[model samples]
Target: MTRILVVGATGLVGREIVRKALRDDRITRLIAPTRRPLEPHPKLHNPLVDFDRLPEDAGWWAVNSVICVLGTTRAKAGSDQAFRKVDYDYPLAVARLAHRHGAMRFALNSSLGAAAAPRLLYSRTKGEIEAAITAVGFSSLTIVRPGLIGGDRNEFRAGEWIAARVLGALGPLLPRRFRISPAPKIADALVEAAIAGASGVHLIEADQLAAD
Candidate 1:
C-alpha cells in the first residue's frame, strides 16, 4: 500500500496519471491537490490549493512518491512570469514539501529540449526547475521529457490542438522522438518507475516514454 502525491491533477497528463494510479493495486492512496476540485474517488483525496501559496500543513506531504505533471503555456498563463510560476515555482515547491514529508521518489513531466543552455525561455525555465528538484536529494528521481502530448486536454490551447491534429495525420512521417505521446503512456511510465523502486536520477526521453 503506497501513498502517492500528485500535483496538477486537473490537467491532461495529470488527470490520466491520477486515473491510472487509482486503478493500480500497488497504490493505497492518492493525495491530489489542484487549483480546482475534481470528482470524488474512494482512493483519492483531492484538495484545492493555490499554487502561489500552498497550505502550511505538514501532513499534506506524507506520501511514498510525488508525481508532478504541472505546466502551462505563455498564452494561457498571460505572461512569461506567470508561466514560470506554474511551470517552475509551483512544482519545485511541491517537491520540497514532499521531500520534507518523507517522500523518497519524484517523477517530473518536463518538456522536450529542456536544457539550461537553451536560448528559449520555456526550455531554460524547465531545465532550471529539473535541476532544482534534483538538488533536493530525493532517494530516486525520474525526469520524463515528453514531446507533444496527445490527449483530450481540459483547457483550450489552439496551437497545441492544431499541432496534435496535424501531427496525428502525419504520424508515420514524424520522427519517433517528435511523435505525439499519448497521456496514458506517460502515466504508465510514471507509475512503473515508482513501482520499480529504481534509485538515483533517471532521464526518460520522448522515444522511451512513448515506448513505455
Candidate 2:
C-alpha cells in the first residue's frame, strides 16, 4: 500500500490523476492540497491550502510518494515571474518537503521541450524544476514530458485550443512526439510511476504516452 501526495489536484492532468488514484487499490491514501475543496473520498485527505504558504511540517507530508502536476500558463499567471513561481518554485518546494518527510518516490509532469539551455520561458522553467526536484534525492524519480495535452479543461486556453484543432486534423500524420497527448494517459503514467516506486530516474516522453 502506498500513501501518495498529489499537488495540482485541481488542474486538468492533476484531476485525472486524482480520479484514477482514488480507484487504484495500490494506493492506501491520497493527500491532495488544493486552493479549493475536492469531492470527498474515503481514501483522500483533501486540504485546502495556498501553495505559496504550504504547511511544511504537516503530517500529510509523510507519504511514500509524490506526484507533482502543478503548472500554470504565463498568460494566466499575468507575468513571467509569476509563471515561474507556479511551474518551478511550487513544485520544487513540494518535492523538498516530501523528501524531507521520508517520501522515496517522485513523479513530475513536464513539457515536451523542457531544457536547461536558453529557450522559451515555459520550457526553461520546466527544465529548471526537473533539475531542482532531482536534487531532492528521491530514490525513485520519474519525469513525464507530454506534448499538447488533449482533454476537457475547466478553463479555456485560446492558444492550446487553436493548436489542438490543428493537431487533431493532422492526427496520425504527425509523429508520435508531436501528436496530442491525452490527459488521462499522462495521469496514468504519473500514478503508476509513483506506485511502482521503481529505482533510478526514469523519463517518459510524449511518444511513450500514446497507445500503440
Candidate 3:
C-alpha cells in the first residue's frame, strides 16, 4: 500500500483529488496538511499547519508519493512576491520535505503556459516551480498543466469567471488545448499519476487531460 501526502487539499481541484485518494484502496494513508481542517476520514491524517512555518521533523512526511495542487492568483496574493511564494516557494518547500522523507513520486497541478521562458509572470512562476521541483530529484515526476479550469470556486475571480463561461459555452467548438478544463478531470489525472508513480517525468497537457 502507498502512503501519500497531498498539499492544497481545500481548493477546488485539490478537494476532488483528496476525495479520490482517500477512497483509493491502493492508498493506505493520506496526509493532508492544511491551514484549516478537512472533514474526518478513516484513511486521512489531517494536520493543521502554517505554510510559512511547516514542521520540519514531522513523521507524517514519510510518504511514498506527494501530490501538490497548491497555487494562488496574483490578485488574491496581493502582489507578485506573494503569488510566487504560494505558487513557487510553498510547493518547492513541500517537495523538498517529502523528498527528504523518502517520497519518490511527486505530481503537481501546473498551468498550461508553464515553461522556462520569458512569458507572463504567472507562466514564468509556474515554469520556475517545475524547474525547482525537478531539482528535488523525485524518481517519478508528473505535471498536469490544465488550461482555464472550470468549477465552482468559493470566491469569484472576474477574469477567470468570464473566461470559463465563454470557453464552456464554446465547448467542443473550442480547441482542446485552449478549452475550459473541468477541475475534476485535472484532479483525476493528478491522483492517478501520483498513485502510479511511474518512473521519469510525465507532462500531461490540457488537451490530454480533457480526454475522457
- Per-model TM-score on C-alpha atoms: 0.94, 0.97, 0.97
lDDT of 3 by residue, 35-65 (tens): 9999999899999999999999999999999
Can you tell me which runs of candidate 3 are displaced by over 4 Å?
none
What Cα-based lDDT does every candidate model obtain? 0.86, 0.92, 0.90
Candidate 2 lDDT, 58-176, residue by residue in tens: 99999999999999999899999999999998999899999999999999999898884557898889889888998889999999999999999988888999999998988889889
> Using TM-score as the measure, which candidate wins?
2
**Residue 103 error for model 1, in Å?**
0.5
- For candidate 3, which ten residues in a row score worst on lDDT? 112-121
List candidate 1 stretches off by more than 4 Å: none
**What lDDT tens digits, residue by residue, belong to model 1 across residues 54-103?**
88565868999999998888887899899999999999899988898899
Best by lDDT: 2
